[model samples]
Target: MKNITIIGGGLVGSLLAVLLARRGHKVDVYERRDDPRKAKPWEGRSINLVVSHRGWAALRLAGLEETVRKITVPVYARMTHDPEGRTNQLAYSIDHKANWSVSRGELNNRLLDEAERVPGVTLHFGHRCEDVDLDKATCTFSRKGAEPATSTGEVVLGCDGAFSAVRLKMQFGRFNYSQEYIEHDYKEISFPAGPDGTSLMDPNCLHIWPRRYYMLMGLANGNGSFTGTLFMPHKAVPEAPDAGFDVIRTEEQADRFLRTHFPDAYALIPNMTEQYMRHPQANLVVVRCSPWVHGATAALLGDAAHAIVPFYGEGMNAGFEDCHVLCKQLDKHGDNNWGAVLETYNAERVANGHAIADLSMRNFIEMRDLVADPRFLLRKKIEGHLQAKHPDRWMPLYSQVKFTDIPYVDALREGRRHDRIMEQVLAMPGIAEKWESEEVERKALELLDKA
Candidate 1:
């Protein structure tokens, strides 16, 4: 068995430790933060994590599927709120398949609990990774109070997040990397439950208020509460006058803006202004890098390899798939063949990392603008209808990414092809009304055949 060191101890790193430990490897997981179980970080505020097919596949491989399911609330559709307090529902799948929502901090603590139960797994909390000796598979970690600690293993897995210290060490070598901070920033607004602990909004659907240039979203917690987020540009552009945090600097401005654009949300959140000003607006970033490995001695996984925008909600799922794929590579080439396994994994995942980064940005535009457009909604109906009638021949891009095990690279390619097919299908006269008709189906099939 190999000695493995996993840095970060976040969602992806903790899961990787469990997967590796179960396979007889000596696994050590290091976290920069305090222990979530003891600290209870999910209590006051937490962004809900959506666990889709890819994440489940990894959890299932680790035998934690049923356990993780207990903490999640199933989200089968999106409930979009309009400017006039109107609402529209878009089902994620025609047959109503769901993506599970669990608090990010809760899931992390649960995974650490599971990781700790394993005989070969050891978790080191508050041990911030300081430096790494990539060639020797060694890492130095700085604890909060005590002296710096150093550990060496046969392999170091850089599961540290986007701003990873392990990745910083990798940067000293021949690496290609780029970090892009999007124009958008976001703040969390808590939606309290009713007196009897019942959800005021539909708990089974994700709630979105798409305002063209900016948006607000809410995901349910099982206790009848919701965590709402407001995403807007950090600074307003000439084109979007009322779409930036800069426009809502004061409490009065924030209150007026919230009530005007999202009257329904403003009503639901009683102290919207208080929470809006209480929480800090966090920036979003996307980081992409090449060769997520260093000669089989060290490698990166999860956000260290690809940090994507959260619009697609596949960030954690993609990272879990990394764990799933890496474990499979070990099974294919045996545990001792680190060279072959690392090379194959890096070759396969780097392209997928880049593809998902692009896909997430595309989804951002869809969520912020197109979801509120009549034509875009019509296109989505047609895509769903086509998938219902021709399951094998047509699968919507969202389905491939969220509902199936298709790689992100393959999903992005198929999604682009679907876009081309839909463009022609939607061009047909009366397509808005005939989207469910057989003629529209035939035309779509023909276009698919030609493409």
Candidate 2:
């Protein structure tokens, strides 16, 4: 078995360590941050995570499915709250398959605990990787009040997040990389449970307040409280002066904004203005890099390889899927063939990474604006009808992404095709009323075949 060195013992790093160790590989994980299990509950860069099919598959393969499941609440649908506080429910899947909602901190802690339990795993917290020897699979780390330390393994994996130190080292060579920061920045808001500690909103649904230019989202916590995030442009959008975080900085402006745009959320969060004003706002970034593997001696995994916007909530899931796919390549190439394994892994994942990144950006508009549109809702209803009648012939793009193991590149291709066909189907006369009619089904099926 090969020895593995993993940098960044966050969610993906810890989970990857556990997976590699299970194969009898000696795995050492070096995390920059102090041990989260011993620290105050993690409040870092968290906009609560959504673990869908791919994520669960990886966790199940790593033998932590049930343990992780205990902490997740199943989200069956999205409850959209309009500007006037009217609500609409749209199930994620026609058959009501759930996407699991989990706290990033909690998931990381549990996975770290699970990794520690494995005999072949060793976790060294506070050893921040500063430099790497890519060809030799060595990483030099700095720790508190000590000389720099180094760990060398047969293979080094970078599970560090978007702004990865390991990835920085790789760039010293001939690596291609780019980082794009979106215009929107997000702030966290807490919605405490009811006075008796029961949830104030529907715990089973992901609550969304879509205001087109900006939005608010809430996901239930295990303790009946909810973690809410407000996403808005950093500067005032030229077309909408009051829409961005820049213009909504004052407590009075925030109060009026919330009361006008997200009245339902305002009602649920009594300290809405305080939370808005006091909490730090974090920017959203999409990081894309090429040739994740460095001459077969080292590789980048998870966010280090592809950091996407959180619209689809597939960032972690895609990273988890990366681990699973890498292991699958190992199994096929045999564990010791690092050259072949890393080559195949990079070839298979890079395009898919780009595809998911684009799809996520597309979903941002869908979540922030399209969800509130009557045509968008009507289109979903028509798509649902098609799927119910012709399950083998059609599945919504959302289901393909969240409920299936299909490659993301394949999903994106199919999703675009679906969009084209749906555009035509929705333009048909009386689509809103006759969505379930045999004529509409025939039109959709015909377009699908032609496309």
TM-scores, all candidates, are 0.98, 0.98
Question: Which pairs clash inside model 1?
Answer: none
Model 2, range 41-155, lDDT digits (tens) per residue? 6352455888999999999999999999999999999999988898899999889799998999889999999999999999999999999888889989999988889998988
Tens-digit per-residue lDDT, 1-451, candidate 1:
9999999899999999999999999999989988878874543357987999999999999999999999999999999999999999999999889999998988998999999999999999999998899999999989888999998899999999999887888888799999999999988888999889999999999899998788999999999999888889999878988768888888998888899999999999899988887788888999999889998798899998999999999999999999999999999999999998999999889999999999999999999999889999999888887887889888899999999988899999989998888888889988878889999988889989988
The TM-score between candidate 2 and the true structure equals 0.98
Candidate 2: C-alpha RMSD after superposition: 1.1
User: Clashes per prediction?
Assistant: 0, 0
